[model samples]
Target: MLTINKDKSRREQIESVSIEQLVPHDHLVRKIESAINFDFIYDLVKDKYCLNNGRPSIDPVVLIKITIIQYMFGIKSMRQTIKEIQTNVAYRWFLGFGFSDTIPHFSTFSKNYERRFKGTDLFEQIFNKILQQAIEHGLVNMDAVFMDSTHIKASANKKKYEKVFVEEQTKTYKQALEEEINKDRQKHGLKPLDFTHEKVKLKEIKISTTDPDSGMINKNEKEHQFGYSAHIACDKNGIILSCITTPANVHDSMVFENLFNKTKKNAGKSKRAALDAGYKTPPICKLLMDEGIVPCMPYTRAQHKEGYFKKRQFVYDEYYDCYICPQGQILEYSTTNRKGYKEYKSDPKVCEKCEDLGRCTSSKNHTKIITRHVWEEYMEEVEYLRHTKECKELYKERSKTIERVFADLKEKHGMRVTMLRGIEKVHMQVLLTCTCFNMKKLANWIWKKGKGGPGKGKNLEVLLEFFSKVVLAIIKPHLSFIEKWGFVNNLKRAFARFSIFGVLLTFH
Candidate 1:
């Protein structure tokens, strides 16, 4: 049976409906709004604002929040983000705007970004703030850190490069490193290396005309394209602690110390670090050891050459200060070269009679020469750690930590290609993206632990308890003075504002 229903029209009457009522209670935007504390942005940008301004600027907090929403939702551009916010009820509610309020112009974002936030550390401060919140929730472990870098295609074209030769700047640690090398040589009873006759090596590089700070990088059998490398340091739980941007031509080993210094400052002390083969150089291994960090890294490709004995096969005897070969012959130390390798030479006469000579040496002289760096011991230490059961487990976690972070950033956050031209703008983009990532993680964690999620509400309660305990512990040591001041409750309340406690009180 078919039936038709008649419709009637009625005149519209003025009715009121709250934006909060239109949005669902369990929406992601609601969770993000409730979980993140954006008040800090006001203090971060306070100095940029005039006290008696000609016109009150669009709230800095709202400007930054709009940008965050853009990245979090994968909006293509600022204009699109602004347009979407105009009609989206959830976004309007998050930004505290009424149904008919005007959205800021899209150009306002770029102008504010360039004028108010350019050449500033506001983004980094925001990133650190979110990270600190994660720390308070016990979502990160600072005992071990995993590090890696990835290349992002620059905004410049492949053909828009100019070749130029430039003198390389000497490293600030060169003098200290040379001193350490000389000390190591003396300790090994070998003559120190002389740098008086060393020749300086000049290098040539291609720079992009459009983005001069970007370096040229080659793709698979194609022309070189300008790009930059983004180095990230993350904890064992895959939370990024710090990040750095450099030209693609820069080596991973070159920026390691600089990145680690920032990581230490931001993430506190990490006793163990996991890295890939690109960071397996002797200096890197040595620096990690000097800082009391146990490094976990795989062996270099040179160790796996076919039809030859590996370097480890030549047993080094510390007492005799020599290497024992496969044929029971001692290869005595000769000289430490200018490159800091201690050379060991096997007797050619002894090798001539040995049946393993063909397998040992391809040289016409029929003599075997082995070179080991001055910091070879640190490399060996790292090799030992790589094989340990704990380090083997850490390696398995590495793929989940830093590698997964890179995958999420590239696949979801649009980090594979740069929309900004210069390195500074790229840095700003990365900082905002990373900060949003941490915020999202923190929000999801809070939401999950609140109800029928993994920890079943126990996690949230525990986190709150942890925050309270930390605050109380800091005050308890000076209980007498605190009691004298009569501000114990006020102190607790003030610290609560910085943690999830305040949010818990507001919502729960």
Candidate 2:
């Protein structure tokens, strides 16, 4: 209140202090410095070269550490991420950087993340790293698990596809050939081949300039879009254990079998599996039972499409082995075990003139055909799952836990479309995005622990001491104005050094 004037002597001292030390003294990113485990991932790819000639685009250890950093902080691009470590006090400290050093270019990050490390198993390595950390931290409850799948867009774009007329298809193909021919001809003067050959046949071509391998499909009765589905298996605490990717057209119901098998391998035999209505089916229920897993999928909507008494209405006669329909009609064995279970059918002669014939059979002269699986007893067990309170609670948690995995990857990690154009590339993208999700969750948990959760004061002190030393120059910008992270000075510096393509090389 007493000082209103700016004097040369007073300003000089402040200027010297500012000029001498622009970096922050207390870095907030220290909370995440030692939180994640990168060694497990580093050990997996230590000998594998990201590039040919025994050269690595990125040291496997460095790549994983930086990628985990980018995910935890929600950094948008690789270039910006590096700049953050260079200038941001918190990031620098967390990344273990010292003063008088340059941050790696954004291109370095993109190159490794999008290109070299694009393999899904590599990402799975990262995910397992965090999962092991969570297990060590006692954050994952191995007793019960809930699984559900949702669509996580591949790195492809919607603009990659457009409807083409049949007549114009050949013309388009010819034009593309002409362009390629011209380029090859003008450069190397290569001759054109015959167009009348029998090998070419396609009515319409899928042309996505951004990502060609990714197909366009509709979901939730919505407009056409490009993407893949993310299938996740998470524990009861909503901690993800495994995730897989499939084409957009692949239904969630179909992927349940393999996903269940993978989850079983990952969790071992003790955990109970929870699923949703989308997973309810006779085939899947039987498989889970064989593996000694408790099935909790809700009844399929097919059970509610009312007509002539759904399968539930057919009462079985134990002593004589037949079905008793609601109309007091006894369906005695007509075909002997042709399609598993005791065979039963209505009398065709009696059905020809029956009053309920119109509603019961597609043909007036034919009786309805119903075949039960040999494992009908397990299906009965599935039906009983709906009657319990615990099952209902598990179903409610299904949406909350699994759906958010997709939303986070798509909305935050720029995983809406795949850049690589093939099933292999798309699958890897799904795996990586899932791994990214787990690392971020673990980072947040570490921060939460430091801020005071169930743990010893001594252990917290030890963690803080170790992190503080590694991240001495971390910058913690005022939290009130953190929304400007996208345009932070460090981010701009990072991007200027590397275009998106340059960044992609770091990953591949």
Candidate 3:
């Protein structure tokens, strides 16, 4: 018989509920709370708060927890996060807010950031502190790190940009490159190229008027937009050791040193670093080699005209200080240019009638030229390492580590686009996003180690027993009706077999 209950008892009934009991034992927030001591946040933000004068303020710990909750759950905006906290029991419990307690407004964080945290390293300090905890817990492995960069679309519109000529900032390695160039020139019996009188080059580029700090990104067939690039370095466990944000137009190699240095300082020395083709430049390879770190990078395709002989075909004779072409022609070394490349030129008269001239040289004079940087030897060493078994295996971890980190940041943490404008604000967002990721990873790892709650094996057993009992209870009432169809006997035999197997497994 079909019947409808007219009871509204539960809706009108009053009951006592404890927030702690409301949350599950294996909840992520509970695990995070047990694994991490958020009390340290108080010490970090103490100086920012008025100790003796201001009115009783919202706990800085709560404020930080609110943001953590926002990123941990991939909430889109602070406003929505605050709204969630207002109704979410677990979030409120994690934040130490009672059921009736008021949640902070979304604007509270913005005001605090502008007045107290802006221009301060508070966000970075917090990030480092969380990373330190992970290190202490033995969750970080810095032996072989991976590095890459991802572009985060800025909040500004791409069409709201103006073309302006800006003086290109001199490279930080300019002096080093100059000294190396001069040394190489002296070795080649050539005069050093003077760089003192070099003009400052001004390049015209699009600048977003709304977010002037962001640059126009137009690469990899992606949509042209104003954005910022986050260059990140991570350990083998995907714990981010360092992150630096710059304009989207900034090349990955441009920020390699700063990011690498920060990672070294934070996580101690790394034996090897796996990089992508964008970091296969001479200077980057030289930097890693000078630091005694092996560079593992993929093969970068050389840019050349179709049907022409590749640069690799012209083998350099180190003893003779020249290049030997396929036709056995010697391309003698000429002057070292200011850009740190040694120009090797072939004899035009000798190549004017060669059979392979078409493949070798297309110049009007039939001369072939190749340029090699002073640091090309380091890049060659990297290429040599690329063929080794150790480096090949290390390079394979890039997808599992740094690439996955970026994917999580974009897909799960809402980092694909920024709601902020300035570079500093965007950096803060990156730091917090990364911090939340580390926190979740740390918490989950600790939980799986049998510290958060019941072990996985025990949980599985408990679930099995509970489900088995519930099945018996539901079938018990229907056994008489089921027996008429000759199904109860088979069901009884199946449960008996399952119960015996469970007991045997438990004893085993």
Candidate 4:
């Protein structure tokens, strides 16, 4: 009763008759193609290369597109990108590859990026283009844009980063000094605890390292890390508006307001700039309010420490230009400065009889002084934003809006660190990375906009139609002896490259 016969379930075959019909079709590659200024980029890079007598610039359009295609799929190395392009038929088609062609080598890409077109304003152009395009597409929501900062970890150059002290004038921990001495001795011939090359940049010698001025110590903080901090701005759709990098030692308060102002031109309709406490300062507050930006940042928690009178407790008399203490004590105005700031010192007589002296005054002479930055209007407004529940919700949105772009740039593009050194060199490198990033994003959008993704034979049929139109227009007489339709389709397999097949063979 057990059925063991595994017979072939064969179906009958029948002879078939062939049928053919002429169908009307036309190629409209123009409509599906993106409206990017590839020619402008090409012209710009070409001009730069001509100025530098650069190595063969492989049609800047093609080179940029290839680089972008690499980025879209997260390919890290240029060499691998070249190989992929040379092999994959869809990739080849996207890059306008003709049969029997070759991709540019890795070295060419490196040399092009490193030496030529280094400081060109290409990134700004690309960024501007994207912003403009997003504006056109109504994708950018500039209403009360969110603000945040993400630390991009730079590539480590062992020589550039070393033990550095806070407050460059020699007052450092014994362990720190010893570590510095050890570093100098192991690398340079300098002796221990000498302070020769510490703060004194001698003409006779400089810190001999692979990178000369990669971000150095803050000298005022416990953490002695030396690198750059990127202040990035983005719209609701997560496209970058602007970015500025400063020495890691640069106070976040100083750069915070400026970053907001720098991105104003790119803001489609934004009115508020929100950031963290790292950007809070008196001068910065004044600058932001003056520029009509409703700046929002949380007050520093240090003010609420166990043993300090928070600056918020000090009340100012704009009429008398002085500070009034809580104990009905009048602090005399010390000076009226050009910065519109006035400093007030607590009356010595009042402090002499104050009840909470220890909790309030730590001054050497029992004098408590407070300086009014004269920009309290902005501070008051910003402080209000911090207290409200709505602003709190807005602040939470900032991380997703802008930080995602940074993650893509760092984790995906392998640009977490600068490949170069020195402030100028690093700036250029950053601009270049941003430029490449935007181009890649634009190219990806363009590739996908053509009815389907270019990587999936989206344009192959249209390509045949294009060639057929061309043949009908000019080459029909020459090909009359051979009557054939869809000739490009017939030629596809014949001309297609098996380089990718070779790649498959290698794995096999």
Task: Give the number of the best model, judged by TM-score.
Answer: 3
Residue-wise C-alpha lDDT for candidate 2, range 243-268, written one tens digit per residue? 77766656666777677667767655
Cα lDDT over the full model 3: 0.88
Q: Name the better of 2 and 4 by TM-score.
A: 2
Worst 10 residues of 2 by lDDT: 165-174
User: Residue 321, candidate 2: how far off, in angstroms?
Assistant: 4.4
- The numbered model that scores best in lDDT is 3
lDDT tens per residue, model 4, 327-446:
768787665333334457887777977897777778878888776554556676778778888777777776776667788878776566555456665665455565555545554555
Q: Order of candidates by TM-score, top first?
A: 3, 1, 2, 4
- Residue-pair clashes per prediction, in order, are 0, 29, 0, 4
Worst 10 residues of 1 by lDDT: 499-508
RMSD of each: 10.4, 19.5, 8.5, 18.2
Off by over 4 Å in 2: 1-28, 49-58, 79-87, 98-100, 109-120, 155-212, 303-307, 318-321, 332-344, 404-429, 443-508
Deviation of model 1 at 25, angstroms? 1.7
lDDT on C-alpha atoms for all candidate structures? 0.83, 0.61, 0.88, 0.59
Model 2 / residue 307 / CA error / Å: 5.1
> Would you list the clashing residue pairs of candidate 3?
none
